[model samples]
Target: MELRVENLTVARGGVPVLEGLEFTLSPGQVLILRGPNGSGKTTLLRTLAGLQPPLTGSVSADPEQITYGAHADGLKATLSVEENLRFWASVHGLADIAPAVDGFNLRGLLERPSANLSAGQKRRLGLARLLVTGRPIWLLDEPTVSLDVASVTLFADAVRAHVAGGGSALIATHIDLGLKADTLDVGPYKADAHRPRTDGMRDAYADFDEAFS
Candidate 1:
């Protein structure tokens, strides 16, 4: 499957962050999004993942086929490492947790509660969840944050394996993850700050639409 974006305009709080953007992601390919801070990398990823609506244009991909990993590790602090994986596996209708465990080197911390793990361990767990989802497309935002040199290699291996298995990824990060991928710089697409401020009005209207729909 391929994901195509056509004349896409994405906004953050009603301010256009990327306008007239276009790209296509084919199976087994990776696209790296590069930009300075506040250049809308995260917003673009969120929009592609369908967490938010695009202000204009279209993102042509099945939402169910996409797995998004945000900057924050979405874990239950009280749950054991294995339990957390199990929960997500069940949610995704997956039967095997072995792959995820082995992929992230979590075999040693299976019984440890998420609250007690170090930042790198937690990040590994978060990335492992993507494997269990069985989704073909990965939308990762700064996935290498807080990872040590060795851990970064581990993550890079996982990404390589995923692509080898016919999966694709769209990653937003400042550092190189050692993957062969195309780069997209979002700097030129940033919206002008001098434009009118309609974010509040747009948000209020969105709330009204959600309430009535």
Candidate 2:
């Protein structure tokens, strides 16, 4: 699988955060995002994940084939670890979650509810959801938050295996997972707010809801 982003622009709070962005992520590869806080990393990821629309430009390849992970963990606190995996598995039409569970060393924590697990355990469980998703493209934002060094290593290994199996990832993170990958700094891509859009491409100011995500 290959993800090609071309001339993409995304916004937050009705203002462009990133503009004129272009990149390619090929199969068995990882692309690391580097930038200071509020540099639009999360906004870019959210837009790619279809949680929001771009203010301008297009996201090439396909957005539906993507899976997103973030710091929230996306877990149901009342649900047991195994139950949570099963829920996600059903959503993606996958029956086997063994690979995901083992990949993150969650065997011992499977029966425990997410509310009872430690922060690191929850993070591991969250990343494991990606494996069961069976999607080729992954959009991760600060995925290492709350994870200890060992857990981060485990997450890195999981990502490596995912890519090795013909998948690709675009990660918005600062941690060096020790993977062979390219890095892109989004700071320079910040949108020029003063520039006028004479091409009729709707600016984020066009709609209050659509551009605010």
Candidate 3:
């Protein structure tokens, strides 16, 4: 499977953040997106995942084959670790949860409620959800946040295994994930100047009053 983006333009709140972005992701490959804060990395990932509409250009990929993991770990606080994985597996029509469980080393915390688990533990469970989806493409945004060194290694290993299995991943992160992948720096594509800059509350209020009045 391959994911392609051509002359893509992404915007946030009607303000363009990135433009003329182009890339293609092939099976057994990982594309790491690198950018500074507010450089539109997350917006690009969201666009690719089909969570938001692009202002222009196109993303060529089947939405059904894409599984997105946002910065927030989307686990039910009341559900146990195993229960959380089970629910997602069922939703994706998958029967086996063992691989996901083992992939993130969540076996020990299977019976613990997500609310009781630490940040890293919750992140692991959240990442495990991707495995159950059986999707060919993964879109991850800041996936390594709150993880320890060992946990980062585990996460990297999971990604390696996934790509080895002919799956593709597009990850946006600032920290190093220890994966051998092509890096795309979004600095050049930043559209910050395309939108007017506000320096302080006075400028913000002026614009607000201008629009409302």
Candidate 4:
């Protein structure tokens, strides 16, 4: 799958956050989007995911190619972990999602409502939705937000496995995902000329913990 964005610019409340941003994402590769607070990291991910339209430029994605996991967990608070996965799988047109559900170790929490789960558990459930979707392109925002060190490592391993299986990801995070991917900084392409200069690409994330905590 291939995702191409040309001169993409995004604006919210009449304020331009990203300008002249271009990206070409291919299968089996990962594109890491990094920037500081309010640097349009989430905006970029939203734009790419088609949740928010770009103010300028075109984003072309292959059919059924992109699946998004937003900054907030999209699971329903009223539903149990298993129900959430089953619902999402049905949405993704997957009849058998057991493999992914079991892979994420969600068995123990199967009967627990989303509201009852811990922050980390919720994040894992959201990730399990991704595996069930089986899409080639992933638009993930802060994937490790509530995960512990071990869970984070497990998530990283799952992502690596996804890439190895000929999938790709466009991750927007303030922390390091340890994915060995290319980095794209939206900070430098800011449209605000009056705003004070901030950090550069190298300063997007000092460490992965900064992105989550």
Candidate 5:
């Protein structure tokens, strides 16, 4: 499956940030997103992942084909690493966790509870969940946050293997992962400050004032 974005508009905190964005991510490919802090990279990914709505435009993809991993680790603190992986695997009707565990070199930490793991370890676990999802499109935001150089390489290799197997990814990160991929800089898409921005809920009820305000 492929991801197609057409004239998309996304907002943060009720303010439009990115407007008229467009792109297509086909299988066996990667697109790296580059921008300064608060550049709407995260907002764009969130819109693509269906976490929130886009103020305008569309994202076309096969249903259930996108798996997103953001800043939060999304781990169950009391669950052992192995248990966490298994839980996500089961949710996706998958029974195998070996590839993910080995891919992230997480076997040694499998028996430890997530709360007991270090920051980098937690991030690795969170990312490993993507492998078990069996979804071809990966939407990642600063995925290497707490990882060391070695771990970052491990992640880069995992992405390579994923795309080699007909998967796709949209990654937003500052550090180069040395992957052969295309880059997208969002500077040109910033929404003009004076443009009307809303969550699409406001209406002519405006002058209706305090009644629905």
Candidate 6:
């Protein structure tokens, strides 16, 4: 699978967040998106995921090209972990979600409501949904937010395995995830101003919050 963005410009509420950004990604490649808070990293990921409309330019994608995991856990609070996975699997046209769930070490949480899982467990469950979806390109926004050291390593291992299996990824993170990838800084892409954020989505895995907590 391949993903290409050409001269892409994205805006929110009439203000530009990313301008003239361009890149192409192929299977087995990983692109690391680096930037500070409010610098359009999240915007870029959202645009790539087709959740947000771009102001200009185009995005070309291959067949079954993208699977996106955002800062939001994307889980139903009322649903059990297995139910959530099953729901996503059905949506993505997968036959079964068990194998992926096992791969992500989520078997133990299968019976628990997503709302009852720890923060890191919730993130793993979200990622498992992507694995079952089986899209070749991954757009991950702050994937390591609430992870402990072991969980982080587990995530890194999964990422490497995915790339080796001919998948590509674009990750937005402030902390090092210990994955091998070419880094791109989106910090300079945003126009400088203290504008109030109009987008409702919050970073699910912000490191600062973990530190403060």
Winner by TM-score: 1
lDDT tens readout by residue for model 6, 1-213: 789999987765446777888889888998999887877888788778876667678999854578888887899999999999888888888888877787779877888999999988988888777777878899999988888888777778888989999998898877777778899887656653554444322231233235546
TM-scores of the candidates are: 0.93, 0.91, 0.90, 0.86, 0.92, 0.84
Q: Can you write out model 3's per-residue Cα lDDT over 108-201, one digit (the tens) per residue?
A: 9999999999988889899999889999899999998888998889899999999999999999888878789999999888775556533442
List model 4 lDDT by residue over 1-213, tens digit each: 789999988755445778899889988899988888888888788778876556679998964788988878888999999899889888888888777677678888999999999989989988888888979999888888888887888778878889899999988877777787999888778887454433422233233225646
Order by TM-score, highest first: 1, 5, 2, 3, 4, 6
Task: Indicate whether candidate 2 or candidate 5 has the larger TM-score.
Answer: 5
Better of 1 and 5 by lDDT: 5
Model 4 global lDDT (CA atoms, 0 to 1): 0.81
Lowest summed-lDDT stretch of 10 residues in model 2? 199-208
What are the lDDT scores of the predictions, listed in order?
Answer: 0.89, 0.87, 0.88, 0.81, 0.91, 0.80
User: Given candidate 5, what's the lDDT at residue 141?
Assistant: 98
Give per-residue CA lDDT, model 5, range 89-200, as digits (tens).
9999999999999999998998999999999999999999999999999999999999999999989999999999999999999999999999989999999867664525
**Index of the highest-lDDT prediction:** 5
Clashing pairs in 4: 175-208, 176-208
Q: Give the local distance difference test score of model 1.
A: 0.89
Question: Best to worst by lDDT, what's the order?
Answer: 5, 1, 3, 2, 4, 6
Instruction: Encode model 2's per-residue lDDT on 1-213: one tens digit a residue.
Output: 677788998877666778999988888889999999988999998888887778777777676689999769999999999999999999999999999999899999999999999988998999999999999999999999988998899889988988888999999888789999999999889887776554334543455455554
Error of 5 at 194 (Å): 2.9
Question: In model 6, which runs have C-alpha deviations exceeding 4 angstroms?
Answer: 62-64, 192-213
- Give the count of colliding residue pairs in each prediction: 0, 0, 0, 2, 0, 1
- List candidate 1 segments past 4 Å from native: 197-205, 208-213
The superposed Cα distance between candidate 6 and the true structure at residue 197, in angstroms, equals 16
